[model samples]
Target chain A: MDDRSFVAAQDFLLSSKTFWTKQIYEDLKRTYEDAVARSGKTPTTPADVAAILEGDTLYRYFAWLERHLQRLKYAGRYGLVPYHDERRSVLAPPLRDTGAELSPTLEMPSYYRRVDIHQHPGGVMSDELDGYVYERGARSTTPLMGASHADLHHRFTDLVAAQDAERVLYGRILDMGCGFGKSTQPFHEAYPDARIDAIDLSGPCLALAAHQAPSRSSPKVRFRQMNACATDYEPDSFDLVTSTMLVHELPPGEIEKLFAEAARILAPGGRMVHLDFHAIDGPFARFMHYGHGLRNNEPFMQPWAEMDIHASLSDKGFTNIKVIPFQEAEGVDLENHAAWRFPWTVIQAELKTGG
Target chain B: MRISDSLILDRPEQNFFADPALDRAFGVVMALATEVYVQRDRVRALERKLEAAGIIDRADMDREPSEDERQANAEDREAFVEGLMINLLGKQQAKGAS
Candidate 1:
């Protein structure tokens, strides 16, 4: 119940997670290597990798650690859920005046409401204080990020900044699925001149995002509670449309709709870039990534990765489509680094100009 | 369209161990491990405070360890992990031989 106890408990969880990320993952990789070497056949598909590692005891422990570490992070004794729930009175008030517009009549998507995404007890949208819980829980999701978790978002924003010539003044920017505004914060700071609109299905998250922003940023960056697949914005409105770790949350059909919505709202020649999990290295990695989806309550990750993103973008008249591996941290080798990591990737495309 | 009431839903369960009790036992072990770590951290903090306030004579225990000692600590940690994961790993193949 004490703050120190809670802090210590969370710290222990983070250390355990780091152990899992490094040692357990490497051991499993070795197990996979040993399995294939004995079988004298290379795994060409996720199914092959699955067939090889599914029954192995170490593999089972690895998978169990991957799932339950996250579960314990948010829902265990001294977890973020109850900790924030206890402090709701103190924490919830500051979020109410952040200039976020709530949609009183917007219907909750069935997919969003069903599964507890990221194993956050009652989903991020259910409780008024769930946003606070998510914000705390997110700090330790990738154990490697430890105290530098915000660096990932800043790196993503920089990646987007690198591609644009007019970096100083982005006219209109839209950040879809901006949970607690972590992804949007970097954009707001980078393009202070840009008119930014951050939208998410969770009002609590939007409120927290708005609250986190500087008071003077009002009327410049508006946090709106709206769905990514459908919004009340006009066509050709946004100069730069983006989302971070959003697409993989949606089902394949919804992903298509979100792309269509982004295309429709983006101005001609506007850039649409998204940072998400994709571009996995091999079948072994793919097997782990998909298993992550099953254990982590993110059912859409595997489907999104398998979807023909290029064709989908081209279908929406997007040009200059580029899907590249994103280095979330500096000096992380995409090829050789052998720790458990999200296959961070960049998906980018530009709307075609008029003939 | 509305969110569910329970914290955990009856989704397709992922069972790593053969028996469900084993899965739960691991969870308990991890939870207990976290508690133990927290308690140790609290005690360490209390000791530091006591030393700072001149409540205890800890001059001999304040120094950093030698490089060899650090290496020994690292080996101890490695041994701990290996012991915890004993009997879980499978037999090594040719690639694993090296």
Candidate 2:
């Protein structure tokens, strides 16, 4: 099919999703609320919400759309997989083993190679054009983000900048799990003086990150293949260690290890911030999110939501720990938004001094 | 074997509905959504053809949808879920809480 038809199909699907989010989701939530009220018990766990609302038709459709609409979006007739597969030769140039602009050889971790991770067929590390596929898939990942999706990275960069604007720049910045440089791009642009070391397990992704870097006098960012949990950096090296949507992909133990690594790498009084899904309002929301984990092939999401991150960060000697909701775009209220949206939260912490 | 290998054709999908009738009903609604998407592409193709044939002006084609059209879009979505609920509700049992 032509690009026009593909675009048309994708747009229509998005409109359907908007309807699902705006109209149908409100219906489902009201039904759930009414059920909970009649049951006379507030749901404290995902199981509690599921026990009440799982059988409801509205909730079932909401759950089904959350799963299959995304599947169809990527694997549909004019989906990302088939479209990119057709353009393999054109997409493969960035993946060439060039003279050290990217990693010399890929060392993919066993844990990284394990799951498909967001039902992307082969995970981002395996395929040559997987980076291209992921970038396209991410566009519609949160349909609610709309055009402001571009602002998510920039908005987050500003939040990090607000921590200590002047001191934050020109120091070492590490972006863990920097997929195709989407998370890394804003940091480099926002802090022109800062030195950035962006790392992920996927060499192809790293190559794409290097290829897509904006033309400049010199490269400000270096994309490398490194697991976040275990790194090759010296102790107390970086001024800031940050990740966007990375922790939820990792297992609980791996998340803990990553925090320890972040602590190990950050200098005294340095900061670390991560943007991920965590601020679930109630058990109904939790039920939907946990179901999303299973339906979307991400096993770690529920566990991460269920994790007590404050306690974990305290154990890692991190101070000023704060996990609060983040408004991704303007006027999209973080609180009391009826439609479905990612539970965007900023997990910020500072490494304790001289401890 | 690698995940990319042809041996593994299908991975896991949503099978939350235990009842076969409910499962079939849900599948039907999904199929309906798919067909609607297909039809939408056809509509776009027809519009493009008309625009190309000099039978329809750009302004005519780009005219904003009227209030009736806007209302129809919302009502159709509401009616779709209303009709779907008839087939789906009362057919499922609240089980598997643990």
Candidate 3:
């Protein structure tokens, strides 16, 4: 479908809430019941039921439900509030000098900690299910991922064409929180010489990523289970490090640690790019973001948006920090074309000279 | 539970459109409801298994749902669907603005 029709479809889906409540929700409930019955256990609580179907396939199904729900929801509330509420006390800027000390005891909150919920069955986050959920969700929405792939390829190709862009050619590349390897695989194709490693805390997701990576025939990229804040890799090891839609999932303190980790892992002159949401210049857009975070249980999204990430990276001894607003579908500048697109952005930074 | 009593599932702070927490809650509920529905069927199928295993008394296991209980369950489902619709509408509004 063309862009306009895709946007229309998205709008229709988002606006019709009752239909989904009756149909989709019921179907999901039925499917989950069927799956659990097959598993041979009767769960007394919701948590127990989740535990029963806690795998990639189940996660994909959950993701499918989530995306449809999100799509329906997104259509109705476009540009309502600040996507990030920086003024809120919970989202107040982090203390600058938290230091290089990594707390071994630091653990995520119980609700936020577990790998299973984060990578819900049949959802985009469940990498173990290949790109089934991710690809299908994107297709159902508006060809955003398909467009993103084309955009990334174009962007990398353009960057490669530029003079003095030799670094894009080779070196170890790390994709932090590389769910199902969508972002990671493209880099491998773009820079065939680079040794790529994708990391996440979910084993199922990594398993899916590993399984899917081979089809691209891009040197069989390595997928590892590792926290974004702490990694087993040596310092200054990677020439390029990237993450997509990950930072918003982390609280402000964790984001600081992530920057530190990226700083530690990147070689001199290496760059880091994170694809995520941004603060739109308008109040309506900003309000939408704030509401989105609060309603969506993206606990850290507001804080992450309000964060002076450029300054944070600077403090982490990084230079040339920039948050570039790109199209969710095209990854192109929205201001340039006024294409009705998702409000996604990318923040790119480089280690400063003589840092 | 009284069949006449109305059950209301209210998510006061929940934003139907953009809140992932609500979305996750919805997902969990969907999964739970699905699991429960499936379990009911499984119990019917496993009557022999339960009798052989002696998890339930074979004679008592045949008890049917009471009229009141069935009415209460139907009410609960209706309430759940209603709340879900409201949440879904809120979400749709949020999505449209984006």
Candidate 4:
């Protein structure tokens, strides 16, 4: 497809997604409330809500749109996957000379191999230009996040930069699962003097990450292919360890290991901050989010939410742990916003230095 | 084989809708959504053509769109979604008046 048609198709998907989020979601929420009232049960769990409303027409339509809209976004006639496939030559490059390490032989964990993880044709790891594909597909990930998408990353960086200066200071950072460097870009920009080592399981994504980086950046990010669960780095290697939107892609067990690895690598008095989806607004939202996991091929989102990061962090002997709702936009994160949105939250914990 | 034809059926989300009518209706709505934006783009392109032909001045092109223009755009979108919603969901339910 020509550029005009391709962009038009993506814009259509974005508008359709906005309609689903703004209009259809409200209708579905009402249907859930009515169904729960009929069943005489105010749902306390997502399962309870699902049991009550999953069979309703509105809920089913919501589910169908939730699934197919994403598929349509990535795999439809002018979808990102095929579009990027055609532009593979434009996107593919040699990572070896770029100073980024590529592991051609790392055994992809079974959990990563099992699911497509975002309705992408192949998950982010498979195709050579899949990183470029992900970067494009991300443009429409949340329709509400249209032009202000860049601002969300900047807002998150502001939150991290606002960390209490007296508590923990950082000179070196590790960004886990930094796909295509989108999550890592702002950090490099914000703390240009601080060294950043970004690792992802996908070589394709790391290659793109390095390619996208500005060549002369001070403390330029070193992109490496490595599993977040078990990195080769020694303990106390990083003053700050972080990941964004990655924990939800992992099973609870892997998430546990990831936390252990981050904690192990974090210097004493160092912090770990992650921006991820959590803080589901209500029971209806919970029902939809869990069902979204089922429909979108992300098997672990609901389970990750259920894992309770605060408890896990506390168990690892971390101090000052907090899971707070992140304001992605000025007013959108408030509870009263009628549109459907990811329950963005910041989970932060600090390793303590004790006498 | 076309890349689009490759199997997406591994997950239940691929083809879970049981009713053919609803499924086809979804396809129609999505296609319509795509065309709606396409038309808007065409309109903008024509406006740009007018500016190129010196019909609409460069200053006018540089200026922000009027409130009237913004309202018209919003109304067009509202009408389109309202009609499309009514098509997918019958008028009674789609009206959604409390």
Candidate 5:
């Protein structure tokens, strides 16, 4: 198609009411109803009703809405006719301060604790639903699958490559909270010599991920259920430990425990890389990000973003701790020369040998 | 509207003149809005009918719906089809002279 025709086609796809009513809207409603029915209860409260709507379904629906909003916002800037609600609900209130709270007894706000649409048996972070939601959300945001998928895959690989490059051997790589194996598959593919173990707390998502991975013929990628904060793995077992978009879902205490676990599992010279959001420097940038967390039902995101991740890593006895801005499309940029990409960073730390 | 000899209306042209992305976004938004409006109207109508039938107390039923309850009922499939016409017609007008 010519440029004009292509643009026209794109416009039609975006604005066409029939497209949504006949396809996405209908399909989503059907899926929601089926899921609710499968759960076998008519919930009286919004929270209970939300629980019945599988996390994947909620994730997919929100993913769809988010993309639409992105397009609308993009279009609005150029006066191309804005589409979505410019004024929507803001993010929820910050967690009540419980100073010096050392335990994992921190109670998540009701909104944050509510079950996601993906029916993520627990919540967004711990289950296979995370993988499904992330994959579906990522794919929905970008339709051209090959390059987008490859870019993310390669970025993940580079993270692994940075750790075990000298030896040319990756003994075992553990991907904690390996949602749908999107971040996990790359480790296996990057180091074919290594065994990749993906862990999460959600059984349904794990089952789905297991089924999806082999169908795509990924090698040596295994999915299992285990909390990231407390895994059953032996100490110093994994040569490399990694997690993607996992840490933010956890509260402060859980996050500390997770780092401790990663530190425990890493052999000498072994590295821990966690792909997540970082506190963007400056006040205005910080405000925009915190606002995003509140409006998106991401209760812990703001706290996670504000926490000194580098300090956390260091406190856990990990050396060479650094919060490097990670360009998801292009791996870690040591020189830091990219512009106009989503704000994301990876916390890269190495477990100190003995003391 | 009289029924003529059975005619298939060429699957009403799917293309919207707007940007494909915009079309998709608007389509979903409009559909959702329409769905919400229709559902709201249906529930109101049902409540009215129930009141007329003496099934529910009119004064209690006449109270404005809670936002959360409205959201649930609006998206509820059981209450949706009854509300379809309002959304479909409303969307046509919102689409402009296309």
Candidate 6:
């Protein structure tokens, strides 16, 4: 298809997604509320909401639109897959010069290899240009972000920066699951002096990350193809270990392993932080979040949300653990925010320093 | 690193509606809506280009069509409706045959 055709089709999908995010989602919530009110019983869990509105036409429409709009964004005619696949040769060259140290022997995890994460046809690792496809797809992932999609990453980086007031965290930083370097770039910019090793299992994503990364003037930022759950790095190597939107992609057992890995790699009294979706507040919000996981092809999101990160971190020899809601934008009230938004939360803990 | 067939997967099937056919119908609607949007955008682009090139005045383009032109357009509109209705008509005919 022509460029204009693809652009228009994608724009239509994004517009439809905006409607689903706001109008349809609000209607579904209202219907659920009305149903609960009439039932004269307080609904407390996802099961309760399911019982009330499982068969409601509006809820069906909302869920259907959520799933299909995402599917169409990647698979059908004028989809991201076809658009990039057609021009793979042009897109593949620049990505190679990114200086990514890709590991040939690193076996792909079944959890990641099996599901097409975020409903991107081949996931980020299969195709040569899947990184480009993912980058484009992520731009409109949150319709609320609109034109300032990068603002979320920057906001997250600022939060990480504010954690250590006494010292600038520019010493031996490691970014886990740094997809295509969106999460890593902000760190590179924020901590120019820090030796940042950004790692992911997706080779294509790492290549793109390294390619889009800042110039080699300092040459501190390095993107490598490595698993976050188990990396080859020596113990106590990094001053700070962080990941954004990564933990939710991992299964519960694997997330525990990731925390252990972070604990091992991090220096004593070092910080371990992650920005991921953990459903806060009532069960209707959680019902929507888990349903989003199923529809979006992110199988691990529900499991990851249910995980007890605070206790898990404490068990892994971490102290001062904090699991709190993160406001990704300026005016996103944690207590009362409307529309379908990810429960952006910051999972932070510190390794106890050796006396 | 490698592009293996096994590494990729087809889109996971999700059934929100009870009837699979209804799910397929919604998919068709979205696909058609995307195409419709593309066509609408192209028409707008064409109109702007024509106006910019001084081939047509903005006011004149906005004006109502002549009786003959209106008659021709109405026939085209009917043909468009018929094209969409053909599938339903075929299904009805098959039901009668059965």
Candidate with top lDDT is 1
lDDT of 5 by residue, B1-98 (tens): 11122211232222222335654665467445533544555577678888889899968756898898787887576566757657766444455665
Off by over 4 Å in 3: A1-68, A71-111, A114-135, A138-164, A167-169, A215-220, A330-333, A336-341, B1-98
Best-to-worst TM-score order? 6, 1, 2, 4, 3, 5
> Candidates' DockQ values?
0.31, 0.13, 0.03, 0.22, 0.02, 0.45
Tens-place lDDT digits, model 5, residues A235-288: 878878888878877777778899999888788778888888783654333443
The CAPRI-style docking tier of model 3 reads: incorrect
**Deviation from native of the Cα of residue A181 in model 2, angstroms:** 1.0
Native-interface RMSD of candidate 1: 6.7
* TM-scores for the candidates: 0.89, 0.84, 0.53, 0.83, 0.52, 0.94
Q: What are the per-residue Cα lDDT tens digits for candidate 4 across A1-355?
A: 6677778888777777798998999887777777777888678887788677756777777777888878777887778887877776655655435566888899999888878878887788988887888888887788887878878888998889877443236679899999888888888877777788999999888888887778325445788899989999998899899888998999999999999888888889888999998878777778778888888899899888877777898878688998899989876847687888888889998997750
The predicted structure with the larger lDDT, 1 or 4, is: 1
Q: Can you tell me which runs of candidate 1 are displaced by over 4 Å?
A: B1-12, B59-98
Instruction: Quote the positional error of residue A108 for candidate 2 in Å.
Output: 3.1
Overall local distance difference test of candidate 6 = 0.86
Q: Write the per-residue lDDT of candidate 6 for residues B3-93, one digit (tens) a residue.
A: 3354345644678888888988998998899989999988888889999998878788689989988898998899999888887754554
Go through the candidates in order and give each one's C-alpha lDDT: 0.88, 0.79, 0.55, 0.81, 0.55, 0.86
- Highest TM-score scorer: 6
TM-score of chain A of 6: 0.97
- Lowest lDDT block of 10, candidate 2 chain A: A97-106
Kindly report which residue stretches of model 5 are placed more than 4 angstroms away from their true locations once superposed.
Answer: A1-134, A141-150, A166-169, A215-219, A330-341, B1-29, B32-98
Residue ranges of candidate 2 with Cα displaced over 4 Å: A97-107, A167-170, A215-217, B1-13, B20-39, B55-98
Q: What's the distance in Å from true for residue A302, model 2?
A: 1.4
